[model samples]
Target: MKRVLLHSAFWLVYLLQDTVLEFVWVGPALKNIPEDVQFWMAFKAAIAAVLPKLLFTYFILYVVIKEIIKGNVRLSWIILQVMAAFIIIIILHRIVFVYYINPVIYGGVLKERPLFHVLSVLLAVMDIGFVSGVAITMKLLRIQLVAREREKNLIKEKLGAELKFLRHQTNPHFLFNTLNNIYALARKQSEHTAEVVMRLSKLLRFILYESKSNLITIEDELRILDDYIALEKIRYDRLTIHFQREIDESSGKIAPLLLLPLVENAFKHGASESRFDSFIRIHVQLQQGRLTFNIENTKENHTAEEIRDNIGLGNVRRQLELMYKEYDLQLQNEPHLFSVRLYINLTSYAQV
Candidate 1:
């Protein structure tokens, strides 16, 4: 639709330009001819200008300049064509000037002023060439701008696909770890084993149905996080988990399964490893089209091999980068503490 409007507008503006030229010639060329005929004469003179422009416009733009840019036309060849164009334009300009501009404006013969005539004719031809050059330059700029926009869109889509794949892979790895937790409880014949397995099944169903999607609402994700936290509580009675959502439930959406990895990493490395100081603190909220999620966990140390080798957190980071160009995710370590802060600008990237 935009292209159509631009195409129509270009021709409409060109026609207006030609009509202005006709108005300029009409006053001088009245010649006692009938009023209607005088108007036609002026219009014809304008056509003489526009028609000459058309002759070289496409030839220079499509054939000469395009081929040269594509490396299919050589420099020497372009030089020769330019020289030929000058000769042709000079002849064409003389014909139009002698037959149209001079006769209409001055009622004079062609050879009456040789030097003045040649200079005027050359100037007219060069003027047309100059207009055509400007037109081509604008066209080249538009083409380059469009190409660059397309390249940027392509990169964004590629990253989005990678993010989707990464998130999908996370589902199974998480399931594996949770199943191990359930298995340990079952081996002990603990009374909460059945309840834990039921909670795991519910979490699995949510991951299977919701995480497969391109986007999940903050409300739904928070519910999933709450359920997972319950399962963690069942796994370890001593674990202390603090979860808070400071925003409205229906605030915004995000790429699926994005927040889970951050929480999971905290619990696995921080709460699971530190028996004495085992706790996870989480806070989330939406502000000005952005979601800020902050999590801090008590950490004994950072040297756990599982914590260092984890790719699940890396996957979430990559997904955040792809889905939200305007986002901040920082994981920092302090004495007995592991902290994560993620800020996502949902307005920057289109929802899937």
Candidate 2:
């Protein structure tokens, strides 16, 4: 129904334009006639002239343009077809004007011209070409709009696939480390083993369900972080861990499971490998739609190559690049302490 209205509007405008042009060209000769009668004559002439123009325009748009876009017809054949159709339409238009319109409008007073007159054919070309050009331009614009929409959808799908692959890579690496901790507790026959298993179950449920979304509330993310920190504390009895959060506003969203890999990297490289007492310090602060996460852990002497080769840190870096445009991930490595600071503008995430 919308398409029908659009086509009707196009032809209506064409008819009005033709009526105005007819008045401008021959209005002085018809000055002796009543104004109402002159307008009626011009409108009648436009109606009579519209039939051939309409047919030729739609034929070129729907038939010739369709075949050209499909690339199914030869160029020479298409050119021959268009030339034949143009000649036939011009002849038909002349027949309509000479036989029907002139007799009614001029009372058969005008001299009869040959059907294939050069002047009549040239007038038909101008009239038909104007309407056809407008229709073809509209058709091409619609095609371009549809092509652009399809391209955007394709790019969105590709990005979604890549994010899923990166998330999958991180999930298994995280579960492996947690499961190893559980194994250690089970082998020692420690009483905290059951509690640790329960915490692991909660973490698994969150990973399986909540982490599927692109974003999650900061409060939910914090809860998961607390749970993971508790599980890690059970595994390392002598390690000093400080997890502090100062949130002025918790009403913000972040990528789910985005911070867990960083925490896991701290324990994997800093606390687990150290022979003496080690400490992990974590600070999370959110204010005015900006979040700052800083984690530092004491470590024994290690080469820069060893720290750079960590899978968890690499995963975190890649996810940050993929997810946020306004974010900074800084790594500070010293002889005895390694630190990571992440600053993100959540306002930008909201815009995205």
Candidate 3:
């Protein structure tokens, strides 16, 4: 609002100055001429006097001033000479129009006297004052635009760095959990421990390489989830783990490493340490430019004490807030089950 008011005030002042000058100087000078002819003549004179100086002022403000402070050779001399030449041109233009043109048409008493030199001096001073004011205004506007652009870029850079840091934190957290699970398997001397290690190696490789990108195909993220589930199933092969996906293969792009946090949270809080015929049902579907994910797990009857904290889920919530500020998120925990439901708009990018 302040900026709008300031700009409005500037334009008001500028137009008022030009209109007043046109009314005062040219309007009276063309008084004896026909109304239509006087209008055209005054308009032409105003253009001839103002256009060149206005163009020159803007060039000096935007181009010369921009380059002059860079310490170029003879810049000061060049600028001084340019200003002197511009003033001379403006003064000459005003003198010719006021003396010869206005006298021939308007037929005023001052036409007999040597009035061109006096009028030229006064008009030249006015031109210089107007040009100086215009230059300062242009300089201030350019500075404001540059400052705004710099601020926007700074914000973008900060968000990029923070998202990268969050991804880094998530990778280590995932590694710690995987290594701990592997250690437990080794302690038990499970026959399928080597297979779990191999699958984990592939998953780690995907995370290290693919997760470095700002964006990746949804298929790649799905493959990472598949690798993680394979590792999980090695430990829970006897229980049911139903994973379903109904995604459009043609639209496959998504933000890299975005979905894993949610999936990891579900597994961390839902799958591990559950008893009494445990089961996890995962559904992922993309429809009408939106992606929906639902994860539900049947909880143990009396093991509520084992799953109280929402560490991974809290991280997922914060990440969602950062990534999809406009999306919907709902998580519910009941006596028999824990579930998460999310619907994210993907129209800004390609959807899958």
lDDT against the true structure, per candidate, is: 0.74, 0.86, 0.69
Q: After superposition on all CA atoms, what RMSD does each candidate show versus the true structure?
A: 4.2, 2.5, 8.6
lDDT of 1 by residue, 267-343 (tens): 78776787674889999988767889999988776442323426777887777766677988877777778888999
Which is superior by TM-score, 1 or 3? 1
lDDT score for residue 10 of model 1: 70
Candidate 2 or 1, higher TM-score = 2
**Higher-lDDT candidate among 1 and 2?**
2
Residue-level lDDT tens digits of model 2 in 1-352: 9999999998898888899887676567776787778777888889999998888888888999899999999999999999998989898899988998778875664565777788877888998898888898999899899989999888778777777888888889989999999999999999999999999899999998989998999999889888998998898867999999999877688998888888988998888888889999999999988899999998897655344737777877777777787899899888889999999987776222
Lowest summed lDDT across 10 adjacent residues in model 1 is found at 106-115
Candidate 3 local lDDT, 233-322, one digit each (tens): 777644688899998763566677777777776666666757546788889998765788898887655343433435466566655666
Model 3 residue 154 CA deviation (Å) reads 0.7
TM-score of each: 0.78, 0.90, 0.65
Which candidate leads the pack in TM-score? 2
Clash pairs detected, candidate 3: none
Clashes of each: 0, 0, 0
